[model samples]
Each structure stands twice: as structure tokens, then as C-alpha cells.
Target: MIPRMGAGVVRNGRELVKGMSAAVPIAIGYVPIAVAFGVIARQSGLPFAETVLMSMMVFAGASQFMAVQMATAGALGMEIIFATLVLNFRHFIMSLSLMDRLKDVPLLAKGALAFGVTDETFAVAAMDEKGGNGRIHPLYMAGLIAVAYGSWVFGTVVGGLFAGVIPRSISDSMNIALYAMFIALLVPAVRKRWRVGAIALIGMALNALFGLFLSGGWATVLATVAAAGCGTMLMPREEPPAAEKTAG
Candidate 1:
């Protein structure tokens, strides 16, 4: 038992190293955007501590930005919570999918893992699992999450601290960096799957239409749901013939 436990520890350590290495690109991508978020949150009247706290607790970039925007616009607490919830609904789907890959993990570990499962981390883990025939090392995932989380928190602190030092014009321009980061993530996925591009366009159009008559958060929620429904309906699925199943 002692030998076996020692081997397990060694294996997990190696896996952690690999996970951290794989997370370098994600860390790099998160820094500028997180800094931008920090800057925006600070400029929008959030205290430096609150800005960092949001990054630590919320962790989702888009939702954090929306929360900051809503808060700055004097939105009510309930409204802010609802908007954040709506925007982060995708995390539920991502977490469910990841659960299948982590069936052998303990509930406590799974809970911790769920908190770190951002879009970028999900993408990386999914690809890694696929390439490894569905075997993802939990320690590796922990390492990946640690690096990404640390980078985001650190970036937010740095941005918040420098918010006063940076010129107003430059700080305002940092807002575009978030959108550019999103576009960078989206374009590659759309290129790989044409359906993704169609869904994105549909969402954009619907959001625009809804924006004309509704609140920003509600418009976003409705457009997202509509686009997802359309995408589900349009997605192609293959069905094997009855004869093929019988032959087996």
C-alpha cells in the first residue's frame, strides 16, 4: 500500500507539471483581458479590493464585465445577479460535460474542479481528453486551473492599482481588448465548425433586434436562447439504418 501510494503521488506530480505547461497559452490570453476588466471595474467606481474580489469570486470574464457595466449603470442588485446568472448559464453545460470525464473523482474534488472550469480551460481539457482517449488526469486539471486563476487575479490587481496612473483615453481603449479576445476565441471555433459561425451570426442579429426594444441583459438572454435553439435544430445528426443494427 505504501509503495502504491508513493507511485500515485509521483504520477500526479508529473501530471500537474504537464497541465501547467499546457495552460501557459491560456494564462497569456487571460492577462490582458483580466487587466482590462480590472481597469474597467476600477474606472466604474468599484474599489480596488472589490475589483479583485470580483475576479476571484466570479472568474468568468464576460459575466464580470457585464456585472461591472450594470453596477456602474446603477442597476439593482437583483438585476445584476440575474444578468450574471444568465450570462454564465453556459458553465452549467460545460460542467455537465466535464462530469462524464471525471466520474471516478470524488465529489469534493469535482466541486473544486467545477469552480475552475472556464471556457478556455474547458476547451483545453476537452481537447486533451479527446487526444488521450478520454483519460484526463485530475491533478493536471488542478494545476491548469491554478495557473489560470492566479494569472487572472494577479492581472486584476495590477490593473486596478495602475488604473489611476494610466491616462483616461488609454484606459478606456482597453475595453476593446476584451472584445478582441472574444473574437479570437470565436473565429477559430467558427472556422472549425461552420455551424458555429451561423449560430454566432444569428445570435448577433437577434440581440440587435431585441436591443431595440428591451434591456441589455434581457436582450442578451433571449438572443442566446434563440440562437441555441436554432443551432440545435440545424445541427446534423447521423442515424444508422435498422438493418445495420440487426446485422451486428
Candidate 2:
């Protein structure tokens, strides 16, 4: 069923392949971060099984790390829960955008698809327009999720088991990988709107200023909120296709 269609059809295999292809960057992108999570989780005194299980269930890198840190600090259960919720609020917005793209699908399909709704998948799927040549195949999302999800889980286990073998020099370098991943993710939007460059610059400036002025983590939240608000306000309107412009 997943192999029979083309780019314009949601069921087309090509679209699925395209989706999977797009997800490749994401798969590679998460490796270092996911490994770092496992490393930190192990270092934090969490049992290996518990660490892996957390990655499996939460499957959310930042929130999982934050939760473990809070837990290790003997923070209250409610505090841990609140922290996780706050960290995951962005995913809720990502999911909402995905829902509109998948509006024509069946409820069961949507429900199942929602399980795979990570930030990476959301970013790729948002590029697909309904009834367009690059229409999103529901199964493509399924396949991409399967691969990316497996990489994350696998990376976590490997990182946890071999955390000791990874040298400090290597571990320190892994942090840069996150910024590279983000740059790749933003490339598409950047291509579409040069104005996005301004948003990113402003957001980074505010983030640095806030981090210097406020407590740790407050800068991230404030800068993100401010940048998103500003980006939305300055977002460019869709221009007519070149062919349409010529016809007119």
C-alpha cells in the first residue's frame, strides 16, 4: 500500500521515500545529542535499564535530560513534571501545525501518526502542501519516525554503555553538533525567506542578553518566546507562483 503511489498522492511510495530521504539529516543530526543524553543519564546515577527505558518512553532529549537532572537533585515530583511539560510545549505547537496538513486522513491514522510527531518530522512534513506535487505520504511519516526513533534509542543505549570509553575531548565537541543540526533544519525556511535571518540574529542576541541577566534556562525560554512572536509578526506572505505571475 505504501509503495504504489507518487509524489502527488498521499499513498505514493515516492513521497514516502522523499519523506524518508528528508529524515536522513535528522537521523544523523540526533546521534551526538542522543549519545550525550545517555552519557549524562549514566553519569547522573540512573541505572542503565532505567536510562534506556526513559529514552524509549520519553523519547524527548532535552526534557529527559532536564527531568533526570531535577530528579537527581531531589526536586519534587511536581517540579519535575512541570519542567517536562514546559520543555515539551513547543512540540504541542509543532503537532498543531501537523494536524492541519493531515486533516484529510482518517482518525485512526492521525492518532497513530501523532505518536511519531517529533520536531524533526514536523519540520519536514510542514514543507508538504496538500494536492501538490510534493504531497506527504502518511506512510512516509511512519517510515521516517521508525528510522529516526530507532537511531535515537540505539544511540542512547550505545552512549550509556560506552560513556566511559568516550573521551572528554570528543564529548565536548559533540555540543557543536546541535548547532549544526539546527542550521540544517532552518535551511529550507531560510531559502524561502531571507527575513528569517533577521529573526535568528535577533533571537540569538536576546538569548545571550537574557542569559547574562537572568537565571540559567530562563534565557532559552524567554528568547524562544520573543523570537517566535517576532517571526510570526514579520512572516512573509506567500507570493503567487512564477507561472501564475507570467500568465497574469
Give per-residue CA lDDT, model 1, range 134-228, as digits (tens): 96888888999999999999999999999988888988898787678679878998887898889989999999999899877677778888998
Report every candidate's CA lDDT. 0.87, 0.75
lDDT of 1: 0.87
Candidate 2 residues 122-194, lDDT tens each?
A: 8777776656744456777777777778888988998899977777677656555456656875788789888
C-alpha RMSD (angstroms) for model 1: 2.7
Which segments of model 1 are wrong by more than 4 Å?
129-133, 238-248
The alpha-carbon RMSD values of the candidates against the true structure, listed in the order shown, are 2.7, 5.7
Best by TM-score: 1
Candidate 1 clash pair list:
none
If scored against the real structure, what TM-score would every candidate get?
A: 0.88, 0.66
Q: After superposition, how far is residue 26 of candidate 1 from its true place, in Å?
A: 1.0
Q: Give per-residue lDDT, candidate 2, residue 75.
A: 63
Positional deviation of residue 66's Cα in model 2 after best superposition, in angstroms: 7.2
lDDT at residue 150 of model 2 (Cα atoms): 80
